[model samples]
Target: MKLTNINKTFGNKKVLKNINLDFPTGKTTVLVGPSGSGKSTLLRTLNLLVTPECGQYEFEKQKLDFAKKISNKEKIFLRQKTGMVFQDYNLFPTKTVLGNIIEGPTQVLKEDKTHAITTAQQLLQKVGLADYATAYPHELSGGQAQRVAIARALAMKPKYILLDEPTSALDPELELSVLKVLLQLAREKQSMAIVTHNMVFAKKIADKIIFVENGEILYDGSPTEFFDPNNPNQRIRNFISSMTLEDL
Candidate 1:
């Protein structure tokens, strides 16, 4: 996908500014920046969750004219094409793990219930939560719940997934479970855009790195170049220095 001259404002605050970005197919791009730096907002814009006030958004040769009304067909196409995994596990409280995973495919995609449930079971196993299929959201631990959420996103068989601080709410030890699932996704060559503060994890998995600050992209490069101490970008060096030893 290619975004050009993207701009977004929330009342008096300019959240995204003349931003231009790209998410290439079959690669993981990590978005790194301080809190309130518009990283998450930018991810939302890519998925069309938060529309930019003005921009030329193109994906698969389809463009969104934000200056004009976005039709329901266009909105649905974007949402279905890119699955989103939020920081919090957004599963339905009343649904079991199996129920949550198959909802989108069965309802939105009009998939056969038996086929969707079969696919859901396979996804659950892939996330290492096959036993949790009958469990409700409240019955699982934080890590388990997030894994289920990932499975839910996968059930749609989307072109790619966008993650917003996926492990931010998990405990240090519990983070490994979701991170392992993500690592497997990376190995599987699943295209993704991730917003994260975990520099160490980013180094391990990111194919491309994009650093945004003050609503603009300051740097975009390969993970190797982004982490190089000799990198001439002082802001990136300063940002790395600011992270906790644990974060690195």
Candidate 2:
């Protein structure tokens, strides 16, 4: 995705100002920033989830003109191409694990139930949740629920997965489990954008690191450069200090 001259604001406050970024295909690009720094906002802009007040979203070489009126059908098509995973696992309480996983494809994609169920089973196995397919969300741990969310997103066969603080709610051990799965997915799938505070995970998994602060792109480089000592960005330094403390 190529974002050109992106600008977003909420009332008088500008969140993303003249932001330009290029997200490589089949690569894990992690957006790292402090809270309320617009990392989530920029990620959401990829699928037009939070439509930029002004910008050109060049997705798959097709530019989505933000100024023009977009039809509902076009929005839905964009949604199909992108899958999102939030910090909180948004599973349906009424649906079993398997039921939650198969819901999207069967309902939105209009896929056959048998095929959806079969695919869901494979995804559940992939996420190491095959045994809990019949369990409710209340019965699963935070890590398990998050993995189920990942499986549900995978069921859509989305080209890119946008993750928002994927393990913020989990315990250390559970967070490790989820991070390991995410690293594996990054290595194997290579088409995801993760917004996270996990500096270690970002260093290990991201093909590119986008560091933002004060609602702007402070640094856009490799994880090596992100961790470089000579870098003069004080905000980056401060953020890394906080991340190190948290990781400990």
Candidate 3:
């Protein structure tokens, strides 16, 4: 998928400016920056949760002109190809873990109930939550809930998974658990784009690192180059220093 010359605004404030990016298949792209830098908004655009006011989005050979109104069918089509995991788990309070995972497949995709259940079970096991099938969101720890959320996204069989601060709400120990599951996904070559502040985890998982600030991308390149201690970009150097100190 690719975005070309995309721009977005809320009220009078521009949130994303002239953005051009590409998310390669079976690779992980990590977006990092300080608060209010538009990383989350950029991630949302991938799932069509937030639409750009200008430019085009190309997915699977289909191109959408953002300047024109997008039909509901087009939005649905785009969304079906992408799964989004937010900072909060956003699970249904009344549904069990298994129910939550199968809802999309059974309802939206109209998959057979039995098959959806089978797939949900396998996904739960993949995320290390096989034993918690009957657990409710309220009954799980932060890490457990996030894992369930990931499983739910996977059950939809999306082409790409987009995560926004997946571990931001957890304590360090719980955060580590969630990060491990994400790392495992990266190893399996799942196509993913993540918005996060965790520099260490970003360094570990990112195939490409993009630094956005003030609604514009300042850097986009390989992780090795982006994370190099001697990186010449002063802005990146300062941002990394601040993030590292914040983590400490």
Cα-based TM-score, every candidate: 0.97, 0.95, 0.98
Candidate achieving the largest lDDT = 3
lDDT of each: 0.92, 0.89, 0.95
At residue 208, what lDDT does model 2 achieve?
94
lDDT (Cα, tens digit) per residue for candidate 1, span 196-222: 999999999999999999899998889
Q: How well does model 3 score by local distance difference test?
A: 0.95
Candidate 1 residue 47 Cα shift, in angstroms, is 1.5
Model 3, 140-234: lDDT tens digits are 99999999999999998899999999999999999999999999999999999999999999999999999999999999999999988899998
Cα RMSDs of all predictions? 1.4, 1.7, 1.2
Q: Return the candidate ranking by TM-score, descending.
A: 3, 1, 2
Clashes of 2: 0
lDDT of 2 by residue, 163-183 (tens): 989999999999998898888
Model 3 Cα shift for residue 183 (angstroms): 0.7
Candidate 3 TM-score, C-alpha based: 0.98
Better of 1 and 3 by lDDT: 3
